[model samples]
Target chain A: MRSWWRVLGVVLGVSVLFVGAWAEKLVVIGPWSGAEADPFVAVLDAFKAKTGIDYEYRTMRAEDLSKVLPAQFGAGMAPGDVIFMWGWWIAKFADHMADLSDVIADVPFAYVSPLVVDGRTVGVPYVVFVKPGFWYRKSFFAEHGLKPPTSWPDFISLLKRIKAIPGIEDAAASGDGVGWPLSDTTEHFILAYGGVNTFLGLIDGTIKWESPEVRAVFENYLIPYLDYASEPIEWTSALDLWWEGKYGIYFMGNWITGMVDDPSDLGVFALPGAKAVTGGPDIFFVPKYSKNLEAAKKLAAFLMSKEGQELRAAGGGKLVVRADVSPTAYPPAERALMKALEGFTLVSDMDDTIGGEWQAAFWDQLKLLWVKPGALDDVLRVLDEKFPKG
Target chain B: MRSSPRAEPRGKGEGKSRRGLPLLFWRSSRRREEWVAALGFLAIGLVLIGFFVIWPSIRTLWFSLFDAEGFAGVRNFARLFGDREIVDLVRFLRREPPWGALLHNLVWIVIHLPFTVGLGLILAVVFSKIRSWWVGIARGAIYLGIVTPLIVGGVIIRFLFDKHAGMAPQILGALGAPVPWSAGWTAYPETALLALVIGSIWLWTGFSMVLHSAGLSTIDRELYEAAQIDGASELAQFRYITLPLLRPVTLVVAAMTFLWELKIFDIVYVATMGGPGGASNVLALEMYFSAFRELDPYRASAIATLITLFSLPVGYWFARRRLRR
Candidate 1:
């Protein structure tokens, strides 16, 4: 009886040791809610099937992710082995992320080139969208004798011509009364003329805000639009303006193409400027305290897989990250975006929702300044103070 | 056995022998128990106070003193003071057209408070007069609004008020009125306020009504009968007796509503994000932008501290009054 008891105890101990040693669960954090969950869920399933490692997924808003991550890293709770984030957020969370330089050798050229943070690869690109392109009603544009303008001066001339039309209102300039489209258009124009590097330099105070080039872009491009937008913009009433064929031009993202899903009323075209190409990159990162690094790497690899790249195209978007995928992975609008990408500089947009020093200084303060009329000099001074010389 | 006569002397002798020590220990033990009870209560209270009130207050106070980097000192507060909008808001008062969103908050409170309280009171009165089953159903229906998540409510409200194809414009358009009710700031502030108020009232009126209904149940029906017999009209009876009787409840509800209105955020964020050029930016939203959204935690804390300071005195005074009564 004593020998039997000893054997039982030994067996129990061995089982316990085995269980403790081989406990594997991957913790993943990403924006995978509702419709966004499909691609991630499929990829996670594929990973599980391949590696036999189960994952715990936590979906959070991109904004909340930024706020929570700092504390999560600070408190050693960042159990995120893999993370899906917006393009601009990667820069803010660069310190806490692991180097992906080895991993990037396998990614596409487009993703590889732009997301190089401080000579270290911080994140990998997965999904890409551009916000400042001109999306116009094709039927209306055709009727009103409008074509996609390929230069800053031509774009203004087109706008002037459209505004001169007897009863047409300029595409919904409400922006919650901030009247923001003017600046967004102006920034793109500046980028087209001077390139992305020059534009970023201006924002960071390396290039002077008072320079003639910057002044010319604003005075020539932005002021005219603002003058046109002097009338009260009724956003709620302007909903059908795009669909009703009442408005000829709308400055927005290609994602607005979904609005034309009714088939008969859909038309989208790229904005043309001196720098005829414009778009922003999407970046994904791995959080510092991820419990399952290998599983995360596998998932990241899968996201950049051929099948995953096809999902991006299926969602009516672009996938420039996977080396296996062709440029044909982009839809019509995205194809134009791809074509335009060669000439115009890629805007180094940051997700302001991510908490950063640059966020408080440039994004939020600029938003407030854009809304209310305040001292431009003071605003510039504050921006310079925040981003001074380095 | 000489027991009866000598027993008294024996008892007396024992009492005399044990007098000082027994009395001293008995009194001391009771005192010690009382002290323990007092200390135990104090410890529990202290823990509650520390967790809920003291710690957050200290953290906020500490945060306000520093800049966004949260070093040690009054730089953030100094910067807030130095901000042009804040300066102009204080110096020029109403002379300034836009008052750094401070005026917007005041306007929100002024516009929404009366409507919320009045509607709540009416709902309470109606609910009280109804049968219990009807009251339950009505209560449930009202609570549905409250139970709906703020984001859901905000989203629905946004859609309901969408400009061209939204329910309002569609209804109006169907009625052959070409008016644009949900368009720009010039036309939409009133509509926006209405939407916000409608949502807030839907979620919160039930709470106030329930409080009022509870208050109503405690009222003496005999007093109402006497008033009615005395030829007092319903309005007069309500004004004179019910209003005075319900004042305590009114005070509680008003303060609660005020605080809730002061901290109004999620609905606005979900709806318009205080857009159309700061049309709906209440102080709470402004503070949030200052802190988390903008990463200006210092200014955010300062604004929160000011709100806390403003609320504390009133809260304490009311609490003390209620306790005394």
Candidate 2:
């Protein structure tokens, strides 16, 4: 009886050890799914190959992450070991996240600074998607004998010419959804007309939203063009319209390269005198409540490494945040945009950086401005009031 | 002979114990056990309601008092009224269509309620008189909208108003009407709210029809025959018999519809996202934006409380009318 009891105890102990090892796979939650998730999954597969650490990727909507993560963290649990989140959200929930300073030490401070909160590095910078400028079809522009604008006047002339095309309805398509696409286009106008200081100052709350420089950008550049603006359509739908030559140009992020039918047909250019381009990195972080904290940290560290960024970049639609990752790893369109970005001052996306109420208001007011240009004063006033000034 | 306890004619105080307690207090063991069993059944439902509904509502009301900075008393309420997104009286006075979220919801209720109720009655009356097999098919087809989920209805609304392939734009274009909504009806400020409201009427008219049809069946056929013997026309008979008889059902339908309109969110969320410059924004969507997007729970709670307050009166009126009947 004593001998049998010893054997049973040994078997139970071995089974426990084996089960623990089997459950070591990290759970990673991200916003991408389907074709959009393909590149990200490729990187994860490579990580799994190099290290025996497997992972389970859970797809979640980007917007739902902000709402879901807080509730999960409040319950002293988390949906996943690591989460890909917006930088502003990382700041908001910094207390619940694990400090990732050591993991992302080699990353540039410019990229790393936004994810820091209360002296704790809460997230590591991942890939960045740039709002390069208005993307036009190379074929459409060539067919219409239209050239990309070199100045503000030239841009207006281009719009007029495009509007005169047989099938075109508008000079530009206004993409919307919670009004962010219009906000992005409006930001481009601000950056081009008001200069980098005015643009950055407005974001940091140093320059008032109702300031003359800001108003001038709206009145001089945006309002006159409102007459030729397409009615606000869903961003993806707007892309389809632009592709079909119903609209001349669409101001969107570099991520459009992946969404379009063919990247080779896409052509992009910034506003004539624009000195800065707005974009942000997709930041990922480990939650403190994660049971597999060490393994999660290892996965996060690997993602930020050049090897992992290279794998992601080669798969297309994303630009690497790491300086060590080569531009050649990207597809031609992304590679060219990456090369061009070296000349421009990279500013973080305004509404994304200043999130919460201000971001919502910004998007809403931009939509209002699009439909009713006369309400510009009211829009600017509301924006200023909603701005989170300290 | 001693009377059995069950057959005993107990006077007001005859069943009382020495302390003057009622017979229920000193009831048989079986009666006490039955009471315990009844309470046990009720306890589960009471506990669930108290935990899920009552506690959360009370908590929301409490939270609404404070703002983002700290314990701001009545400050959030003041903001809720003053915020242009909630009620832009200035724009309304200027005769702008897309006034505010509150005003938009009112617009939805005003237009949607009457049309749905009136059309429902007309369809029910017309269908009742018909004896064709297609009548059942027609009724089923109409009620299908009611069975279909509102989320799916929202998608249907989107496509119905879409410029590219939608019937509305195409039909208008063919008629040589100037189609201003090049992007689609829901994508424009002037038409976003109206489009959703009109589309919603189609979705809800079916519900009203089904209810009214059921009510119509309960009316006496002899009443119409009596009116006809007195040389009453069809319209007169409808006015005297059908309208009066259907009053209770109409009250129920209208009140329920009113409450539904006040809290309408899913359709607006899926279709327009309260966009085209918040032109089609409604109260429930505002609450969601406040809590999730803005991350201001206080303002969200305030909006929630207001929705509940708006709903209470209609609900109260319905319950009171039903009780009176």
Candidate 3:
């Protein structure tokens, strides 16, 4: 009995020593819960194996991450050491993210510029998908005796041609759908005609919705598309028609490449470059209350490294930060058509970081313009009330 | 007589020892019952109330004070009242579309709740009478929906109502001009509401049935035999005996439905996203939009507070009436 008790004492002592040596686990929170690539899990697992540190990750809805994180920190809940956020959402919660200027200096300028907030490097840029101009099937254009339109008017003419074709469906339509394409097109139109500065003004709360340029952009840019979409076109139908060689054009981003590109064949085009969106970065942040700030920094640094960047490219996204890596970041076939085109002036998306509420106002007013024809002035009036100088 | 029984006196030492024993027993006995029952219940009730109710209420109330300029007392509320669009939205309360999408929910409660509760009661009565494998099959079929989560049911409903290959669409197409169930604004809201009703009715009716079954078991068969002896018809027996006895269960089911309808957020969120241009924007969605999407915590809190205030009176009435029954 004495010998058995001695053995139990030895076992208990060893267990106590083992428990004492355990490392504190870090909790990293972000907004990649549903469909987006979970980059954190991939990189963190490797870091843990190397450093003998463990991490716990939790995710909320993309929008909720910003709203809840601030309070989580204030309320003494476990704060996220690292955060992955979209450009617009990051701007809303900028005050809480730590400055990483010293950490991200090795990152290339192209990638770093978009992620910078208020002249401070807040996070590393990882993945980006830019929206650009699109065109109809080259074969369809030829059979219909149509030419590739260079300008917005020529684009309208192409639409007219497709409408003239009796059996063919109207230009890739999206009437009753969410109209995301129309929304994107409307912003581009505003930029193209009113200039990128005007769009920037809209973001900074300096431009009203009733400006002639804004009105002209809508009347010229979206009215023609909406007219073509008289058949209550859903997005699925539009994509199918485009794929089946039944439609003319679609103004969408490079993400739509997966839709348009096929194993057999495909056609692509850049928007008529009257104006273009130049820069925007996929941003990550370290929360102010992050318990594992050092670990998060290490992870962010790894993500920006060549090996980490390769992982990003493999995950099917453009590396925005690599200066040497051009649009040829991926293979030629994988290259978005926008990257191939020359002499296209690229201006960044409107400065959404100036104030978060500005974009909400702009989107609200823009919705009115799209739905109600005569409601522009009223929307503009509301804009004045909200953002007086703008 | 008592004095005579205690006449024999013990030694002083023995008497002192006996007094000490009784004193020790007296000290612990008073607290034993209360320590187990009262303190335990108080601790549990405090924990639940503190965690669930008090915490969220405090957080929501705190968020209602701020604005773009920072902390602005009553500013958000003043602005909410002043905003013409919000005012116009509220005006629908008095008009034909009063209660907005909540109108669909009210209609849902009125139509679906009764059917579900009535069917449940009748089936419960039937199951009580019949003793066979059919009873097992019937119970399983009803409970299949209860076992399935609302989201799973929603997906099934979505497929069933799909425009092209859906069972409804295919059947209707073969008959005549196939209805595009999710096409326009009118059809979109109506179809969404209908889908929710079907999912809700199918999922929840089984629950009501189980409740009614238990309620029915307590009813003595002798009463039914008595009714029969008095020559009371089946309908009359149900009206006089069964219905009166089942009032408490029916009331509980009705209240549950009413509360469920008021905050039917998940089904609507998953199915339609309050879409086809704000056609299905119920109070819950509106609160979420204000709080999360719009990033206006003030308005969201006010909306939540309104919902809480609205339910209080009904909840109080339920407590009173339920206790009486």
Per residue, candidate 1 scores C-alpha lDDT tens digits across A16-103 of 9877654577766765454445545666776778778877778876656656766677786674777766555577667777776776
Q: How far off is model 1, as Cα RMSD?
A: 6.8
Each prediction's whole-model lDDT (CA): 0.61, 0.85, 0.61
Candidate 2 per-residue lDDT, tens place, B200-249, comes to 99899998999999999999999999999999999998999999999989
> Where does the lowest 10-residue lDDT sum fall in candidate 1 chain B?
B181-190
Q: Pick the candidate with the highest TM-score.
A: 2
lDDT of 3 by residue, B1-325 (tens): 3333245365553334335566456556766876778878799888999999999898876777766677877776666556543334564554322134445556567777787888888888778879898898899899787778777775556556555335765666677753344332222433556656766787778978888888988998999999999999988988998889998888787777677667767655654444433344466766776776566777888667656665677789899986897
Which pairs clash (backbone N, Cα, C closer than 3 Å) in model 2? none
TM-score of chain A of each: 0.71, 0.91, 0.74
**Model 3 complex DockQ against the native:** 0.15
Interface RMSD of each: 6.2, 2.0, 5.7
The recovered share of true contacts, given per candidate in order, is: 0.05, 0.57, 0.03
Model 2: per-residue Cα lDDT at residue B298: 95
lDDT of 2 by residue, A248-351 (tens): 99999988888888898989999899988888888788999998999998998888888888899887887887777766888898877777677888788899
Candidate 1 lDDT tens digits, B107-213: 55676677767777778777766777677888888767767888887776666666543676567667776433424222243355556656677777777777887
- Kindly indicate the candidate among 1 and 2 with the higher TM-score: 2
